[model samples]
Target: MAMIEISGLLLLLLTIFLAGGVWIAISLMACGWVAMQFVAGGIPAGAVLATTIWGNSASWTLAALPLFIWMGEILYRTKLSEEMFRGLAPWLNWLPGRLMHVNVLACGIFGSVSGSSAATCATVAKIALPELKKRGYDEKLALGSLAGAGTLGILIPPSITMVVYAVAANVSIIQIFLAGFLPGLLVMVLYSGYIIVWHMLNPDKSPPPEPAMPFRQKLKESAQLIPCMLLIALVFLSLLLGWATATECAAWGVLGSFGIAWWSGTLTKEAFWQSVMGTTRITCMIMLILAGASFMSTSMAYTGIPLALAAWVDSLHLSPYALIAALTVMYIVLGTALDGISMIVLTTAIVIPMIKSAGFDLVWFGIFLVLIVEMAEVSPPVGFNLFVLQTMSGKDSNTVALAALPFFFLLVAAVAIITIFPQIVMILPEMAFPPQ
Candidate 1:
């Protein structure tokens, strides 16, 4: 009952702070301070806060975050998406949805290198939207597909969200990265399949199929895609093949992205400065949130809140799937208010113990967590991708949300598939880093 009251007080304070438009990181810190001083009591809150923030902020695994962000920033300024469109258009032209597949393919490819959902959505849409519209493609399908496929950024690795989960849950970032691969591909295939089915059902919505391009000509057009593909292969394979750590591969990614930008004649001084600034701003935001959440996590521990809650939850003897279903509902509600990272950081304190008690693998749960966040990315109220699409398409959030509805359900379907077949999320990691 005391724990219930403490939880209620903290939740009420957090809701008030967030609703009042406080920055999430600061709101989290304030909540942690309140918990420390009132709920936990007796600890030197200042000392614990300072040390915990510093330790988490200085994490070597986290060094990869900014580097990966910088790489995405550089590519975002380049014509990579344009090149990918040109390369992919001819190959997919005869397929049921024709060039619409480019949105999914390009997002999947870009997401591999970018590791950010918003960046992937914005970057691909910047080029694909105008081009697809020009070719008389269906606006709703293009928009929805880009929005859905963009989530590949977090699921395919070098992912910032994966890094945060790794740090919070104390798992191998590499293993998490590896685990995400097959599932990411699964989502892509599911998305593409949906597009094919949609076009088949409503053939007139898509532009009429064009004549098949000469095989050799298709190959030539695809040459425009070589540099970006090579960079992705370099970054991804290096990590997968054990040639480098996640941080080191990220560094290589940055260098390779810069080289590609320069080689493509798009790396201007202005663009360089912009990429640096973008990386700094995003990195700082994530770091502050990480620091604040660290402090809060520590405070929660000192208060015995998480352990008590876990004990209570365990006593109920809910099955593993039941616990996951409950968490899914909780996270979706939280998603309407908080972004994915904040949700992960704030809940890890309570969720981890329940997960362990249910005998689920944390790494697999990390993938599960990411897919749910991907769902949240398209969800309304605070969905980041919805906001992004609204700005680009000039549609109201509701309209954009409606267009994204199919893909949203598709993401939910992905979660269910992975839940029933956990190996889909586990196979690559086990093969890559087999149990010793």
Candidate 2:
């Protein structure tokens, strides 16, 4: 019995399980069971499964997942977006796209705070959509920018996706967080720059600028931005300065979110409980998937599949750039079916060996993978942000995808930039956390 034959069998079983409507986590575990039983018959399959799931599930670093999620949930229920729009509109109305820039700026800010792309898209769209429509702002630009900027939720520090990737790849979560900052900012700048350029070329696409407000008046109206800014600064600084562990920073975010909600008069007993419940559901789902992925990783190790695949890929002698290009395309295709986190967890165990063999930095690849996932968030059919914007805007998914298309390309451009100058992704992490 050859290893290839055993790998084929396990892959088939996993596919059938998935196509038959088994949950991803369950399917992964079942596949791991099948692999261990048949391919590595000498080992105790059930014992391995239990111990692997337990070990991965009990990680203290994983505690950050629920806390960050809770912070996002709490802030989601507040008037944060509404205030952001109010504060940002006056300041940005003089720009080429008028208030449409609000969508990009607000989502970037809120996404940084929330750490969930869907929440950022939904929260910003809930306020910005109707207001932009009423103000005669171009719907396409508004929708596109929102979809793109919302992805910043995962790219920014405190990102749930980054934490998952870090844990899976055995890298430093803080280093991954640091690595993402520049790429995230690059994407945001590209989105905004495209908006400005597009509006400049097609003037009528943007409404006539509102009369410029006095600088002092604009400052007064923009004061509402303070709380959101303070929260972002606190979460980022605590982690970057080594003042807190990732989990401790997440705790600080949750506490700050609660305080802000209370001051904003949006916190109720019901809202608090809702946030807690939402966090529990999301945390359980991610944890289960993590456990399954861990088991599956172990299964692949025992089967020698990952090592064999890496050796085969190495035999081809493909350059690092070529490998990254192939992966970018693969991830985009996979994005149509799997959400960002699932895509990372599903492939990392096997793909990582190949990536490391190419002499690429795992941390750099982590940032690059995240940028690809950000593109996935806005891809058609199953893009989480596309669905979110569709529900809010009452537009069909295709229409939403079309609206998001330009920003999608903008993400591709960011990927290209980072690939060409890997330092764009690595510099911040390297500078902040200099190697011993």
Give me the runs in candidate 1 sitting further than 4 Å from their true place. none
Instruction: Summarize candidate 2's per-residue lDDT along 107-221 as a digit string, tens digits.
Output: 8888887889899899988888898888787888888888998898999877999999999999989889888888888888898899889988988676766777999999988
Candidate 2 TM-score over all chains jointly: 0.97
lDDT of each: 0.89, 0.88
> C-alpha displacement of 244 in model 2, angstroms?
1.2
Per-model C-alpha RMSD: 1.2, 1.3
What local lDDT does model 2 show for residue 32? 88
